[model samples]
Target: MDWIVPLILTVITASTPLLLSATGELITEKSGVLNLGVEGMMLIGAITGFAVTVSTGSAIIGIIAAAIAGMAIALIFAFLTLTLMANQVATGLALTIFGVGFSALVGSGFVGFAIEPLPSLHIPFISDIPVIGPILFGQDFLVYLSIFMVIASGWFLTKTRAGLILKAVGDSHESAHAIGYNVIGIRYMATLFGGAMSGLAGAYLSLVYTPMWAENMTAGRGWIALALVVFATWRPGRLLAGAYMFGCISVLQLHAQSAGINVPSQFMSMLPYLATVIVLVIISSDQTKIRLNAPACIGKAFRPAQ
Candidate 1:
């Protein structure tokens, strides 16, 4: 009973990065652009955030730097895929490879270095209210930000006119173009936003979650975020549920091993990833639903009318 609250808190922290990254990618997909370089962008963000924090000793600056680094990599993807009409799949793959190598190179000097963990927020009275207080009010900034981002994403997509236009572009770029929407420009903005969010997720990993720098620190969380978008069927609310679920499984596995549950360490380590595969298979089995919900122009190359 005593361990329950702490376990829930750990799950929330684990889910934050996925929520942020997936939410951002959801917006990008809604705008009819598919960028598969999330892993690369996140890695770049991780290294950049760690490096900047180490250099300046300011976590805030580190987060900003991570966002900028992610956007910079995204800009390359946009230029290649949008401007030159390169294959989105290939360009994205290249971006990931580049990011992994780049992050490794940049993080080489900073390996094993640690930073002060981001301070948890404690409301004057609310955070002191037993179990619920710490669970709800004692989280760091990004934890709350992730929840707000989901709400904001839902509102922007369903209640705002701009969101409708972005969806229109995704549904049919040709139609959107005839209707006077700047498809390329909208996609550019959306892609950059996704990149920034992915970077922010990376920063959370290094600056808050682990509070340190390491090679390939993002691991495969970016890919999991992408899968989450698909699992949620482009719906922000569902995305939140899915992220928390995954987070729960991840924390459960970690604690199970720590508690000496007798499971093999390797098998326990694979729990989160195995769950990802199983969920993806289940969701993808419903081809009709996927077809109906997926953006019509996803992964389709777009060019302006001559």
Candidate 2:
């Protein structure tokens, strides 16, 4: 009974970064482009965000820098896949490599810096409702906003004009072009949005959740977020569920350590990544099914002239 409230609280906080990153990837994938560089983008965002915050003493500025960093890295992918028509998988792997090396080089100096987290914004009335109060109301603005974004994403994907256009482009880029939509432009926008959101999520972890920048601090959450989209079936509502589920797993690891379980600390340390690998393998078991869930034009070459 005592664990109920705390569990719920931990779930929300833990879910924040996953929710943000997964949701951003959802939108990008929905637009028909497969950007596999989320890991790289997030790493770049984390370090860049930390550097900015450390120098300016402003969390917002740091977040902004992170977003910019993510967008910049993503653009490199866009240029290769969208313009140069390279292999999406290979290009994405390259981006991740670049992000890792770049972040390590840049973050080495900022590894021990402390960041000031944004002040929590408590909601009136709802914030004082006893046991469930803190979990529901006493959260950072981004936390609540993410839940709202989930709902909004659901609505936007199912019942909005812009969403329809994005879907049309995804379903068939040629048809979308025939109907007068600019496929490349839409994808560029989508890629940019994905990058920015990934960056913000990274910044959130360092500046808020951990409040300190560490080398490779993101671990493998970015990869998990990528798998989350598949677990969600490319649906926004499912994205939220996947994030919460992953959050629970993360929290459980800590609890296991606290309870002094038989598992070695090293194994516990690897639990999150291990869980991520298992989930990804589970979701990726059926190549045909995974392909079907993917957007129709995901890896297609876009020739405007044709």
Top candidate on TM-score is 1
TM-score of each: 0.98, 0.92
lDDT of 1 by residue, 143-189 (tens): 88889999999999999999999999999999999989999999999
After superposition of all CA atoms, the RMSD between model 2 and the true structure is 2.0
| Candidate 1 runs further than 4 Å off | none
Top lDDT model: 1
Please give the CA lDDT of all the candidate structures.
0.91, 0.84
User: Whole-model lDDT for model 2 versus the true structure?
Assistant: 0.84
Candidate 2 lDDT, 121-204, residue by residue in tens: 677878878886887778887787778877787798789998889888888998999989999999888888889888888887
Candidate 1 achieves a global lDDT of: 0.91
Screening candidate 2 with a backbone cut-off below 3 angstroms (N, C-alpha, C), the clashing residue pairs are none
Q: Residue 241's C-alpha lDDT in candidate 2?
A: 85
